[model samples]
Target: MACTQMNCSKNGTTSAADLTDDLIIEILSLLPVKSVCRFKCVSRLWYLLISQHRKRLPQTISGFFYPKHRYNNEDGLIGFPTFDGISGDQKQLFPDSSLPFLTGYRQILPKDCCNGLIFCLCWKDSPIDEADYVVCNPATEEWVVLPDAGHKSDALAYRLGFDGAMSPHFHVFQILEGDEDYGYISGVNIYSSETGVWSYKENGWGDNEIQIVDMRGVFFNGMMHLLTCEFKILAVDTEGKTWRTISLLETMCVGNICLGPLAFIGQSQGRLYFINMRDNDSSKLSVWILEDYNGNEWIFKYSISTSQLFGKLFGEKDHMLQRDYADLLLQRDYALVAIHPECNLIFFVWRCKDVLLSYDMDRGKVCVICSLKYHLYDTFPPYLPYVPSFLRIGKPRVEA
Candidate 1:
């Protein structure tokens, strides 16, 4: 946790003064990810220095500095011979492609990834403990399934996030029954990934009245943001072991806005965006970008309105516009790679691929390249979790 500096050898010849901060940054940027991580300890300046220079670095190196999320379009969502772009249909693309890496995965699906792992929570007709929690790496295609969440028929809610700065690198949040009283709501527990175990349980997280219909937890700026459709965003500091609440931007609450379906678009660079259901119209989409989320303060700086993606991008090859888009695949802001919407399937039908577009976020503009699908879907639990004597928080703590 210390940021003090140490003397540098400078190849055992050049004096430390001979190398300027910029010069050292250029050199470190060229080093392998491992070396740079170790060399950061040389000084806090080195840490900030490398962090600042991270973006300009080549993809090969920057991919390590900050693990890149697989842009759904770039990861070949439709994959292989088909290569259908983002806004394509599923049946049209499936003819040429094989089963998606995660074809059969449905309910409680993992629609996002971080570091190198993805989360999967399977919900059957009932909770029977066949296979419940699974953490996998699509890159390595490796998986780790946790023990039963210990939820009987009474698990009210559940969520997954990471706390690298904490003992256990990952944490699972769950709300379960409180007492024998009918639906009194008992405890909320967080399961740690590092320890592969869960904490006791707490209360008041979600058992009040507002049900978390659509939940997307985003870990950014060293914290986890839990997006719910109930009009409130629960932010938990994975590293700090605390929870706070954030609200949707007022700009997003206009028109046919509904409080039951919200989503965490993703964190790009260092900011987080939340996409919520605006109006029933398929053309009015609104999203908010927030930064400086240091657990205590969150600043909403960017608000984006849906502009027509018309022309060749939105229409067919012949420029015949078909579906009017009410959604976005933010490239400049493209961090949510696991989002698989029904509209994406439509993209397959259209045989789309590698289409270019411009990402305009009110003040800034960037060139972004991504594919399109004909479908759009949200990845949240469809039903409320059952309730039971789920272990309450403060139950007990085991050493990590």
Candidate 2:
């Protein structure tokens, strides 16, 4: 951590300019993401250094964005306040005006966030003509409109991916569901910011055995993991240009455990994890890991008991728990919102709750990280783990 120009002579003849570029980059990378972003105005050298090291620096969960939880929709979209994950403090209140491009749009739906850029479905006043997919970099306040997929479908889901440290470009994957003669047809379309073009692969999913059930996708190790209604996992390989499905064990589909909403798939430590919140009992959740892809081997990892989670989170207030996570959620009125892919943590949002809670799987501890400022009544809002960056879309940078 030594300053490179510390030995320079006193007369102000030497400054940060006298320091080696490598040393400056090393020093700047040590600063917080927001601080580094502000220092981009210092000079072109600093801008390049900060932009290059943004991804290499420690990647922390910056905040969460929920588009659904707002006071009113008539007075424009109310910006949700984001809180810090580490400090459990309010970070910033994002107003609608800040995203000027979204002005006049009736519905602003967030699809995904990857390396700081957000992929959203912006539907204008008219449902047909103005509906389009937009990519926005909230940190830089820059956005780009993606080209159309050339066909219409009944259902749609999207996933975003980028490596800002290695490249300024990013990619978006669109999974479309439509009816066909057989039963259903699912297609995959890819949009690249670098090329400004949409590549379509019809019948992306050959078999109609199980269609993608939801929009939430886990992007890990160059693949996007999607869940199906039949307790199956669909992986869209962006690099390999292929789609494959992984079936859950028959034991997972029998009885109340077969319920799809009671389970979720998360990636941790470079592997896929299948978590099943017990339906009959709210006091436990089962965790499974995918050991082999081809052989379809899933090894049981461990079971997390809610007895401790409940005692720690809700205190000594005990009640009869039935119907598993939902009943526990009804008693405690806490909703299981999301799970982090890079770590052993699960996020929960309570009914009429403003705060976001994180439970560490390894430590068996739960703590408040931030506030949502919105209530979870019928459904959880469109939420995603966001990590801010200084990646510029139009600005020239090396492609990864």
Candidate 3:
């Protein structure tokens, strides 16, 4: 194949030696991930150059992978997974959203995603105790099924902890429910990829009586942060050695007349963020950030009103209309899907409207991303934020 104008040398020879290392990287960064992967075979230098600069390349959060409402025998999963591409042509990255690469398991449910890998619960049949925790990279189609931790049935939540920049190994923290108590947590079972083992530890949060309001936990800065029933963020390290508690906004702690505040905890731009709808006013939504991680201080960053979100304000005179809207909003059908890992944006889904939307925190603008496929049987499905990475699993780290 002939070289393009950008790659051709001055003398008309299509030689890579004609370009500087920086120039080659600049050109490679413009291509898709698959194309960049293929170029590694050209030479040893190209392989090293691409491998070292992989993080600096144009990798992005292609979309989200959520459970499809319907089931198919051919797919061999209880909830057939589907992807919704919100940016670029990256949807082509996953030709079969069903994830057929995972063999042997009749059912696979994605529980959480960190960096680029997905944490899933796999089962051969109906029993929950005979389950395996699998971590797989959708981009590379590489998966590793974890050994049974012996307390799969008692698990309340499974959170994946991984930072490719920090280390090649990953950890899975399984929050175990209390033996006698229903809402209380007993301890955590920690799994490490490096040792290929599962270690158990008693609750490290002291005597706080931890009760997670939501099963989903945010993995950031070597710690897994979970929102508690007390409206506070509880964080624990992957080693299960250190534990810390960060309080939510004072106003958010107050109880509500309706179905409690629609709150979610997430990480973006290397900082922890908490977003929620105001309890007193259903129309108002606020975003808080931990400006200083060590200080545990939360600074109110931005707020959006229903008028700004929906594009029209409701007047008090329309009492019936306002009441209906409030009821719909507080019915626990809406969810803050994800906080953009790289930007001042949030993606959420409104089940009542069957629409997925993005709110820009910087510009205070709301944009409809796409219309969701409404399923009557499905409640609020978890939308895991996914940024595809071509990193291979169970491989030695190639240091840049």
Candidate 4:
């Protein structure tokens, strides 16, 4: 008689040979990026499925990458972990995790995240004349330091592009500011991981004075979007090598970014968003989405009332929602960071109060995510939406 069960209980459990391909893919898709990476070692079939699952399902924001604080003496890439609640509607923050990178000679500053890769700038200690521009996939712990592109500007910005399903490779775009015969010109430089080289596109910013007002760049519609100090939207097409400038709605508050980089632009569910917190009316905040990109139309989405969202913070003594509470949010010490792409969640950090808060747009609930004690300066910790993936750059490019 054959044995009913194998005697492998003492060693370990058996493999999931009974699971079908469709079922395996579905289960792996819901897991976190870190777990997916570890499961690759389970079996060859699981590894293949986890590697290609991004093409089967939609990708959402994983978490955020930032330093502890800008003014603080500590140095390195840091992680602000996010969690999923049992109720599905609730989310919470976990303990901070520091990213592994060299500490002494080089200081890493997290910049942009495209697809699932993060772009960081590594500054040298001694001379400090040139900085190392590096790109990394935090989930897989894969990083590469880019070669010198020969452009030296402190106000430069970066964007990464990759189509994991169509191609196993990715590229980086660097937007640079230069003075020309006419005026300031923003140039574009593209670095291909496959070729291991950088290509330049001169005069990328035609006639427009591209201001480096925002610290991060929004990647959407095959282009990189950034806000200028002049209140105009500056876009650079990575594929077409073109530039376009769209005017913001004409208002007294336009171009007045006195509250630092609080006024931000982000992309959610393929729709471009512009959060206008620069308004003097601090009680209500406005959100704009790019309804018609070709027509340069920005439609009003919604307005959130701070009086209702943060009323409890003021306490029962100040029961009558005072208008000054809104003013407090508008101060330069406050900022609006990441906006969830799939939902109405917004992340805000109040440096003066030393706290990070998340506001749910649908439920109208505000939750304190964490304390800013570790990240305390005016511009200490820079926040960027983090997405985890198993993509490996510099691999052979596949045909679409």
Candidate 5:
């Protein structure tokens, strides 16, 4: 029997097989992000449809990538970058963590990750000045080697800024160090993907005394926010036309010391967050959110102690062992790795124990995620939070 297409819907119902790709995408877009991610496993077609339309749908953090250093007999010092997946289905989007597409480089050191793009310093076998700044997207395997910025690598602090939902273009900022002061920022070199050129601006920040404390900066609300030694947030836009500074809470300041602040800045759920240890008490960690962006007001959101975090993990410890553990906690041996983009989960690395742990601010619970492979020495390794995006960067390249 030759049944007509219109006759098949006589009962006002459509079969699963009869649904078109666009129809399925429309339905998936209405579901929660978790449900939309689960549909990826329903079929290969569903995976492709969702991935293609990911920017329109809500996005969540997939995992994190941090450098793991090892001494190879042949290569001397080498970095083996590792990825720790937090989402099951999303992890499948990036099969290879090594980033094999970035070829012909002695080593690739990831400097910063904003949105879905990673900014890396690709060291060549030639002189240090000949190194290249490479930005790559793992999901699409698209990469682009940027033109030289005409500045020495040693004197520059590089940061990547991209927001796929807001715009397709991305920017790279190279902050230059002052020649005489050495601590103050002398100038800035910005590269725009849309213009495909580098632009220079000399210390638009206006305050030469406020030195950049950390190389990592948080990109939020169309501005790159950097923590300064003065315990203030310095922000600059892509055009270098507008500049703003938000003062940190007076209690968080470590006043006039050469040491960097024990604080980190990150963005989650459309707000800027600052996490730092209490200056008076190192064991107490405080989380603050910029509730009023225009007014520059920071509201204290959560606070937790070292005992509350690691107490359940180490139960019924001996007196001697407990004493040693308390000493380690007092010394602040943990490093804050990342903050969940969608929730109140904070990820940190316990250097002394070499384990990754996540603390839930809402539930007041702490859980160990996994053990780290590489041994961390004096300095903490760069832990970059990654949100998977199917956005294409440059021209697609063949898999290496």
Candidate 6:
């Protein structure tokens, strides 16, 4: 707390050369990274302090708070409402589902989650009317939107990714829809919180004419994975302006196996697993491992005939929402840990509710972690990871 001063009264006459780098970094830690970044423009000392600590700031914050949480930071992507309609745009914390205090995040779409913040994009008209792309922290309820990346076309694709290194960083890849031959192609623009502006460039290979655009970005294997199509997974490098593809499931292996939609299964122990459910209209189910983001290997696992997890996984039921419920999610441990009310009409009487399960990455099998209404198998006790929705004070520091 004493690392940072209230006003940093050392701005004007005090030459930053007089202060040791360690002391400068310490001061920045006492304050929020966002604040340090904002103050970087003041002088070289301030800039160094802010830039030098940008990499360590997130770690510092995570270390400080991860242990403090009942669920810690090892759980899956915590789902919570970003926009409140019933509460009239209120950012107040509530306990209906996710952590009560995990609110105030803008454009809360499931694109990419890193460290402690989630990134999203919002687009529309202009200045007084134009929308924005936001990267935010639900825990601290902090958010920052990106500036436009010189796009002339209305169609655009924003993919957020993270790179793991000494200075692990998160970046957004924005692909503007434009002509590639006539040179109107607005390449993948990069945006970093540490470096606020989006670097303009040209579109990379296989990054054009994407028929299926999956807004749900999966950060896996040191790259960002997005379901580009049933046969391809677009992987973007978070550190560089390069985009590539990674094979999830081979088309020749299972005749007509398609890549399922991606969702955060959970990040237990030390791995980040993506839950993808594949359903068939022939009254059958299949689940595949979407590969864990941040892992060190290219492991693609699949579960065929997954009728065990979600009863009635195929046939007419699978084709219900051709596009809506395209695939089923293999909810894993610590994920879907709480009550998830969605998709009614399960087993004719039991409503379709989200449940927790243990996924065998090696065997493609799923074991229920909680009890279901119909006792899909057997009634298991629910897990209470810290009481939901308790007003924990802010991170003990705040300033505009």
Question: Taking the candidates one at a time, how many backbone clashes does each contain?
Answer: 53, 2, 0, 1, 0, 12
Give RMSD (Å) of candidate 2 vs. truth.
7.7
**Top of the candidates by TM-score:** 5
Model 6 misses residue 225 by how many Å? 2.4
Give one digit per residue, the lDDT tens place, for model 4 in 188-283. 787778777778877555655555564567767666676776777787765536787878883324322334465678777557888775455655
Provide the lDDT at 180 for model 1: 43
Expressed as tens digits, the lDDT of each residue in 1-400 for candidate 6 is 2325432344444445557778777676556434665777988867776675554442311110110112215333332222211122222332232323323332123344454445543433233234556655554454565666665664455665543332334577665657644323245566665566666656565445553333345455555555544455556565546667545443321112122122223232234333333323322332333344434344543443434434433345555443334223332211222111111101101123433244444444444433322222122122222111111222312234
RMSD for all candidates, in order, please: 12.0, 7.7, 7.9, 8.9, 5.7, 15.5
- lDDT of all predictions: 0.42, 0.63, 0.74, 0.63, 0.75, 0.40
- Model 5 scores worst on lDDT over the 10 consecutive residues at 253-262
Question: What is candidate 4's CA lDDT for residue 9?
Answer: 38
TM-score of 5: 0.82
Choose 1 or 2, whichever is better by lDDT.
2
Name the weakest run of 10 consecutive residues (lDDT summed) in model 3: 252-261
Residue pairs with backbone atoms closer than 3 Å in model 2 (clashes)? 329-333, 354-372
Candidate 3 residue 176 C-alpha distance from true site, Å: 1.3
TM agreement with the true structure for every prediction: 0.50, 0.72, 0.78, 0.72, 0.82, 0.45
Return the top candidate by lDDT.
5
2 or 3: which has the higher lDDT? 3
Give the per-residue lDDT digits (tens) of candidate 3, residues 1-400: 4566457866767676877889898898667556787898999988999989876564656788777756566652266567778855665667787678987766777878888899887766545447777899887888888877876547777888887757778889888888546657888899888877788988878743677765468888888888887778888887889988888875453223232337778888779988877666667777899999999889988877754455432345665665556545643545777888778898877666777778788987777777765443445666777887766679422336
Candidate 6 lands at a TM-score of 0.45
Q: Write the per-residue lDDT of candidate 5 for residues 1-400, one digit (tens) a residue.
A: 2346533455766666777877777777566577888888989977888889876675677777877666867667777456777645655555667777887776777778888888887777566346787888877778888887877634547889998767778899888887544667877788888777788877877787657766478888898888887788888899888888899885563321223335778887678999887667766678999999999989999887766666656666654555457535534556677888777888877766777788899999888877766643456677788887767665423335
Model 1 quality (TM-score): 0.50
lDDT score, residue 86, model 2? 38
